[model samples]
Target: MKPILLDVPLQLETDRLFLRAPLQAGDGDVVYEAIRDSINELKQWLSLFQTIPTVEETEIILRNAHIDFLKRESFRYLIFHKDTNEFIGTASLHAINWKVSKCEIGYWINTQFSGKGYMTEAVRELINLGFQQLRFRRIGIRCESTNLSSRSIAEKLGFKLEGTLRNDDLSADGSKLTDICIYSIIM
Candidate 1:
């Protein structure tokens, strides 16, 4: 079979944010520190976040991400503050099931930036990328039910709440089980 050409060199800009490919060498550290410093504030909502990774590990991770990007198997973007040029978060279109023409959106923002509508704006741009450029048939988001902000963003963006997976996932702190709210936008 021929290789799938799924790369898109798209840099999206919102009023206060810049969404671009996660290509820098230390981009993971940029993301790790942003979330590490606010672990307490974010643990409740961001489940994939673990303890702060050392700079070395983050560098390796970032390098690997870039390699994966070239292979067209995954696409991850670092969300940066346009004014400050600071790495603020990460959003990914991964688990791409091409046979179905669908992908899942995963995102996390720094706690300080929460409640500011930044992620919502960023996610909308991601959806546009999926639909317009990637030509995906559907895009989906999954978040913890208790995460009101994520749920609100999904709902506001016209994602239908497909169902709730009871105790489907673990919280970031690993002390509690959380329900996964699956939301999807069908194109």
Candidate 2:
């Protein structure tokens, strides 16, 4: 099996977005605001939902992610609107299984910025990075079945639906089992 983590800096840009490596410790404020502003929207999908971070806590979060990036176990990116360079969302490829040439992608965009095709563009660009640059055979995205918009993005990106995991998520207020619709693209 080949090692997935490389010393090379990974960066991808679409016509409308700047998709680069995750932020460093100095970028805590920006990350905090991005998460805080979109907390309400993110809570709907993520299992480990939390209240908005304060400036201090945000610094800690950035430091941790930065360290993870250095370790090469997970890769997280901050989505930036190209025209305005505005922070839009966060995306990550986690649990990378280099031996199998696979990884799980996770993302969340601000509610206010939803439905403008920003995420779709980001995902497509990221998929290319995974398949072409990283030598990945398949990339998977799992989202709550109720998240219609996310599912639509997966479909738009040419991922084949691989069925659902019944009641696989427990978070927020209830223990409702979320049907995780797995979508994959084999390169």
Candidate 3:
């Protein structure tokens, strides 16, 4: 069956968060601002933010995300504070393997929202969505071994450590080799 025909929700909510696909046309501006505000911290882990992205570029990305969501190619969600209606971070179910019914999750929080537990809550919801709604057999979180915050989120959510890939990739800055930690929860 074509993935595009798969029925899925565009949004999911928690006590403090509202997670949704980039359906709003103006969401790119908001996402761009969050990236600008969090660039320094984001650059530490994500190679995508090594250079500041223009608003137009961010918008294009968001538009693509919307298209991807419709095609069921990948689901990238924008996180917002429920009460405040503030953008807090980004999360996604990417690296999909439809045949295996699995995907890897990735996330980043706005620097201002760090340590607030919002991301953990958001990711927990994503895991649930993957298993319950998407019928995934496995959901994984892969992070740089040095990123304690990222690793802890997976651990906190009960994802077991599957293995570590030494020298899995380069650091965001391309200055050093980085190890990748693989954690997963299987149904």
Candidate 4:
């Protein structure tokens, strides 16, 4: 089946959070704020946040993300608090291979929300969406081996450590080589 014909939900919910595609025009403001507040921590793992982005740049990124979501090229959901409607972070099912029925999950949380298990819960929902709703045969999470927080999410959710690739990629800042840990769960 063509991925474009698939009916993906615009929003998904958990007890404390809601995940939605970046569809609204002003969505970037909140996302930008989160990025600004989390930049110090985010820069360690995510290259995109190596420098703080202006609100306009962030808005453009989100707008493009909306287009990607519609095209089924990738699904980037902005995570938010359920009751307060506060933006918390983002979780994405990306690097999709439709014929292989697989994709990778990528995520980050605002520093203020870290260590609270919000990211774990949000990722758990994405896993369910991939296997059950998207019918993906395999979903993987690949992160820097030093990123214990990310590795923990995959482990806590029962993803197996498929392998670790030594010196697999450059660090987010391109300063040094880093090992990559690959984790996966099959439906």
What are the lDDT figures for the candidates, one per model? Answer: 0.80, 0.78, 0.93, 0.95
How do the predictions measure up, each by TM-score? 0.89, 0.90, 0.97, 0.99
- Global fold similarity of model 4 (TM-score): 0.99
Residue-wise lDDT of candidate 1 within 1-187, one digit each (tens)? 3226655765788889999886765676677688677777676765444566677776777677677767767777888899989777778787788778899888878878888888888899889888998888999999888888788989988999999999998886788888999999989
How high is the lDDT of residue 165 in model 4? 100
Q: Give all candidate RMSDs, comma-separated.
A: 2.1, 1.9, 0.9, 0.6
Please give, for residues 118-182, the per-residue lDDT of candidate 2 as tens digits: 99898888787788777789899888888888899999989999998888776444556566788
Query: Stretches of candidate 3 above 4 Å error?
Result: none
Any runs in candidate 4 off by more than 4 Å, and if so which?
Answer: none
Top-down lDDT ranking: 4, 3, 1, 2
Q: Between candidates 2 and 4, which one is better according to TM-score?
A: 4
| Candidate 2 Cα lDDT to native | 0.78
TM-score attained by model 2: 0.90
Instruction: Report the poorest 10 consecutive residues by lDDT, candidate 3.
Output: 1-10
**Which number leads on lDDT?**
4
- Show the colliding residue pairs in model 4: none
Residue 120's lDDT within candidate 2 is: 89
TM-score: model 1 vs. ground truth: 0.89
